[model samples]
Target: MYIESFVEYNYIGEIAGLLLSGLLLFVMLYVRPKKTLLFKYIFNGTILSIVAILFQISIIKVANNPDQYYNKNLFGIQLISFLLVYNGILYCIFSYVNMMSVVRRNQRKEFILMYAVLSIIYVIGIIIEIAASGLYTFTLDGIDIRHFTRYYISAGIVCAVVCFIASALNRREISRITWHAVCLFVPTSLVVLIGQMIYVVKAHYIFSATTYVPIFMIGFLLFHNVPYDELSGTQSIYALDAYLMKNMGKKKIWVVYVILKTLDIENFIKKDIDSLYYGISICRNLENLSPSLRLYKMSDNKFVNILEESDPGKAKLIIQEIRGIFDKSRVDLDVPFNYTIIAGELRSETDTILKVRQFFEFISKRFIDHNSSQFYITKESDYKGFSEHYEISSVIRDIRLRENLDDERIVVYAQPIYSVGTGSFKSAEALMRLKVGDKLISPEVFIPIAESSGAIHMLTCIILNKVCRAIGSFSEYYDFDAISINCSSKELSMENLNRDFMEIIERYDIDPSKIRLEVTETAMFENYERANKNMESLSSEGIQFYLDDFGTGYSSLERVMNCPFKTIKFDKTLLYKSLHDDRMNDILSYMIEVFKKNGFITLIEGVEDESQKTYSVDRGFDYIQGYLYAKPTPIEEVKKFFNRKSSF
Candidate 1:
């Protein structure tokens, strides 16, 4: 070969080597590089290849001809060439071992032995080159003629063996480019293997290209997808988002919500798990029918969407289907998972991403606030103004931080519970007040925020503590009967709810019987087993139990039969609607009678005037709780309430 053509031919080889070396480094970055002894060889191997390229360039650019300046440096160039080949092989060896680190069983052992054998074959090829081509020769240059034979032929053979070994380690992940290289290299490596029967350098170049396929593919793969390490299969939430984005573009987007019953799962497995796949299955079930709906994982427990194609009627239908799945489940937890999400079709799109995210944030907050049961949706405008008020709400939060802050920001108020026969105030339900400095804010203003941020527990504790303390103090002055405190279902999970209540009652020396606990149907179902147990213990110690909003929330006759409650407070639904609706009247009559026969107390709620009052009196309610007696009042005003009823 002529000098210029010789340099040009090998330069292509040098470029291939450089790219492969760079790719090897790139792949190693995410593969969790261990500070191993072999990586040192791999590093040196790849580095010296750069020196070989520099030596070639210097020979072409700085030297005149073979017999001129470069001839004296032939030994140096030759050594550099040896180092490049040496390092390239070492890199392949290291990468193969690193790649196979995760392999299991005897296959891993077999792989290690195969690489060891390939290394031995490389040594034998070097010995063949030494014997076949003289070890050194020079035409104005002292050169190892055999080195070229060994370097090209030996590497080609090693590559073919390694390629076979590496191909066997294939995983058909769409994200892996090594597999792509195997496809390209395997045939070429075989051709090179056939060509090696006759020792010719020209034939060696064709096989050499095949041998370097992995390095080229690897370098290219560095710029592309890396499976599991650099990039992994979508996380549950991310997968949900990707699916939604892909399917639904600008349209009435709808979401498929899933609730996971992971309690048993968490108990069964101790290791960290990517549970997104199971969650995706839930979306898959929903999409199996309503294939076009967009979805996104709002959180671990919730996913949502607001496609441009969605309508309220269609949204409702999708929600019902998802719910029917849970409703029919034979295993309770599998049916009703820990997460209950509301998927609202977003109708509030504007021109901005911030608006979109704000809309999503608003959607998520309202969805979580929905609390109980089933996949569902609501219009964005219904909640838009509600969140809009938060512009002024932040200032109120600072006011809430003041001394006796909660009390200063909130006024404690109570609504009287009436004994129907006696026409007297028997007990009061404590409600929170949010005040801006001197102005009182309604419970509706902050309870949702408190609940969402997990501040509800602290707020609940404070309110209950104050109510108990005040009633205890009030008892010292007057013969106050008793007080009722509303508890969220979440409160039942307090580490020692029984002990906390016991301590409060014990601290004030208040009779546990004098303290009644009211829980709404909205909150009654969760922690039912633990709640009922706690209530039983409290009742055993003398506390009273009242099931609030009885006509609502899991309100089947089943709860009346299954739940342990001394009293049922019929929801405003029953009392307000009973007058005109005969069916409601009949149901109310049936409910009152069912409780009466069971010796359960019935409290009619939401009576406003004589018309509703007359209906409650006719309905056989043991008691009533509503605005008819008086709205929730301050402690100072309780005296006036009792005095107004003094004539009784």
Candidate 2:
């Protein structure tokens, strides 16, 4: 008989395969990465594989037992057990494919239906197998194992076909890493099919291919373990890049970029609140916007939402909803949150990754420029703005690399400040200008970009050196007492700012008193302790610190009094407002009187005409600066205004 001719049990290969599978199971339980959905499925599948292998070994042992009772009931029990193990493996493959393809919550029904179909097929195949093989002899030698082999092969083929069709239909939605992992299962299924077919032909004991299930699962775990942000419960930037690479240009989509600034996590902690919970809550809210929207936490405070929607109006409405959520949260939550939400539809089919990244960079620039919430970037001008930002960032990077100051890429201009007491322009503010080919880019355009790119420090150093050089060389030809260089918040917060500034001054052999550093109230407050230390150290070296842009920021007169400042420069907006309202004029006069009484020199800038200059001088302003006296000009042009007397 066929059973008598069959080779002896392949105990060596079977035991080795079981040991390997057991080892993989141990690793899966203890050595896996984060427990993402995919990881859990693969882990469970591994457990099932180990169980099936043990059952297969037990069946082989029973078949080889010389004293075993071989009855129809026992045969039926073994066959059913074999069927359960085979079907369980098939279900594992189907679940993995379904998880990859059907990500939307609403599409879960489809996944259940697909699994139900596989289950129905298995039930029908089992019924037919049992009905067709009824009334078989009770002896093991009389039974044909080919009947069960046929059922196993048929089920494997059905599973392979279903998984392949599902993967093909949603190939674009699945990431490249996931797609490769899914494809690996195809060959694994084939191994099982071909191995079983060979067993039917030769009637010989062969190593069970179920052993490879754990190996395949290990490969799956390694390939599909996606990193995610624990706080927000969203995938990390790497997953976002993979998703964008796969889906971009395949369909129209909108990207909503969210940035949360000024989180004040320490403050929240002091109040016994979990600040990270807010981040997670925000992700949950945005995810609720659409079933298909995929959210990724790019960093601690930045999130990206990919929406597979084609309608621009719908996208805008979604953006508005995001804005509303933030606005409401700001008022309703105990901790006030600062958020900027920018959304735009990705129209270009090509260069999707580059374009999306550029848009994000642009959003960052806008956040810095305005420092406000609620931005919608959907127009052509917005894209052009991103292009311009990219170009300016490139230019700033190029300028940072150049060593020679005479390369003319970075130019210094001076706007003369009129001294009311001296009746002449004794000091000039040194401003930076960038010359790209023949076009000169405005400081407003490139300064923010420079700061964002971390090139502002270098730019500040270059400008300071040039200003010191100008004061040393041009002081003899031009009669200016000092040149004021603008210092940014980033520059003031530097630990070595005083050292770097003094080094430049000494290199040019100029008096530290010959240079005045103008810092805005905002800059001073950004990192108050650091800025104050740097300012005090620099002031002790005779480089006077002037509080620029007063009354335009979080102005605290008490805070100002604590700092060592020689002059207070009121912003032009205050001067403009004082001219229009009598109350404002009175308030400005009182402010100027208060500062003068505090023994501080007061300067009112933006004096456009004689009336404005006279108004400032009469109000006890020690200095006046604006376009009326002299616009910002090249160093050569500034020499003409040095000794010129003010009309006021």
Candidate 3:
């Protein structure tokens, strides 16, 4: 009789097996399995494929009735060996598939029952085979049958049980394709069932040939059909900015005007871009909640929600309630959520782009600087603090974007920096002031808002362009002393910082030494290595650094080691509190002394009162800056102050 084998069997089953094997191998290769364990799965599947061929060969031998042609001894050896191999292959398939099934579902009760049943039957079979072996002298009609019976099958069953448990427990962490193989293993297990049906060795080839249905189906499922993405399981999100800008032109981008409440949004949602799209989806639902409302994720952790330009107050109420959903959902929520937030409201629709950025920036700044304090917009009717001023800032944002010029919206103001010991002006700190209509606004009012909205860089360029021009106007009046421009720590971390600064410095025809960069402790320490490298590069080229706001934030040894600033600028709070606090004076004294010993110059900020100025002079501070010297004045005032040394 002819035998069925991949080697000998020419049935549809064998052809499908070969084709499927080739496809699976391609997938394994495509997955780029870099790890050794993944290769082990490949090796195991290969071993199973080889066994199918071997089983086919054994069937042909058994069907020939070899004892009639050859010796009975040869027939017995062949017969027993084939039985053992058949059982071995069956056990392997059963164990592999069963474990895969168990792992995927993870029902311990069901697993235990399955294991018990499989265990009992196989254990009995193994015992019968063991007892009939020659060692015990037991035989069937005085002939031993133990070798042909059960020891290997029992061991095989035990191994299968163990593998099943391990695979079931680890389904998720494994690769999707591996899990595919794991889940479909149930059908692949027909090898064992077929072997069991054809218990006699003579039918092994036929069973192997007919068993490709499950194999073909599993192969189809593994490569051709699956829900997960073949690569990253999610799409890229960097296109978001471009997408919004391209789709919604400046006029249609009206979402910036709606003022939402404080609701913390995670910058990077746990899932990928597709997952983050859900936040936009929920925001889109706002339109239905109020037909004119518009929403989109402006940037990471920042969303722009707009209402009608004609009716901003009506829009604000609707948006406020929508934001309340986030806050209300925080407790025992149906979904995993975080409600911490700080929001900035923009009143002008023209400032749509800038306003969205500012909302995120405002919150980010609180996170970046204020140690998790929340900045919220209280109602104009409820609280009269900075509501009107905040609205004015929005007006300024729209103006800045609209002009796109070397001058407009932002005007230059300078505050004289004086030598404390001599009480003579040394330089002027260039302050950027945004003007909208009849109102003149300080950087303190709009600069922070600019930084929060990611428009700080744009503001910086405006200020630098103005500062350079402002300096050009004053260049002939005095020898160049440094003009310090306030830069965001976030901006420092932006792309090509050194190149950007260099270009600005070169364009202004300003000496690098005349520009002293100031950074707060929080900004300096946030990304110390990048900061250090940037500072070190600038410092090497003759620029200097002043550590702004010492004695605030996580002030530690790391700041001292990492920050290479040439000057230490004391925070206003510390100097203000120093007058009343004896211990605080000691702390400030130690801080100043350490900085002094390091050869860094000290400039104490916020010398608003005589006592504070007297304190800085007595404390050996090299310079002092604040309203005590002068409130930030017009450029002409700064020129006049620096031109006349004894102006104080």
List the candidates' TM-scores in order: 0.51, 0.66, 0.46
Residue-by-residue lDDT tens digits, candidate 3, 399-515:
557645475677888888888656578777787787767777777777766765566777777777677666766666664477888778887766587787778778868677877
Where does candidate 2 have its weakest 10-residue lDDT segment?
Answer: 135-144
Cα deviation at 622, candidate 3, in Å, is 0.7
List the candidate numbers ranked by TM-score, top first.
Answer: 2, 1, 3
Q: Which wins on lDDT, candidate 1 or candidate 2?
A: 2
Model 2 segments more than 4 A misplaced: 1-3, 8-34, 37-207, 210-223, 226-352, 360-377, 401-407, 644-648
Each candidate's number of clashing pairs is 17, 0, 8
Query: lDDT tens digits, residues 536-639, model 1?
Result: 77889988888888867875677656766788888888776778889988978987898889879888878889988888888888887778678878854554
lDDT tens digits by residue: candidate 2, 191-232: 767776677547545455453475445544444445443223
lDDT over C-alpha atoms for residue 343 of model 2: 79
The residue pairs in collision within model 2 are none
lDDT at 449, model 1: 63
- Model 1 residue 97 distance off true place after TM-score fit, in angstroms: 16
Best by TM-score: 2
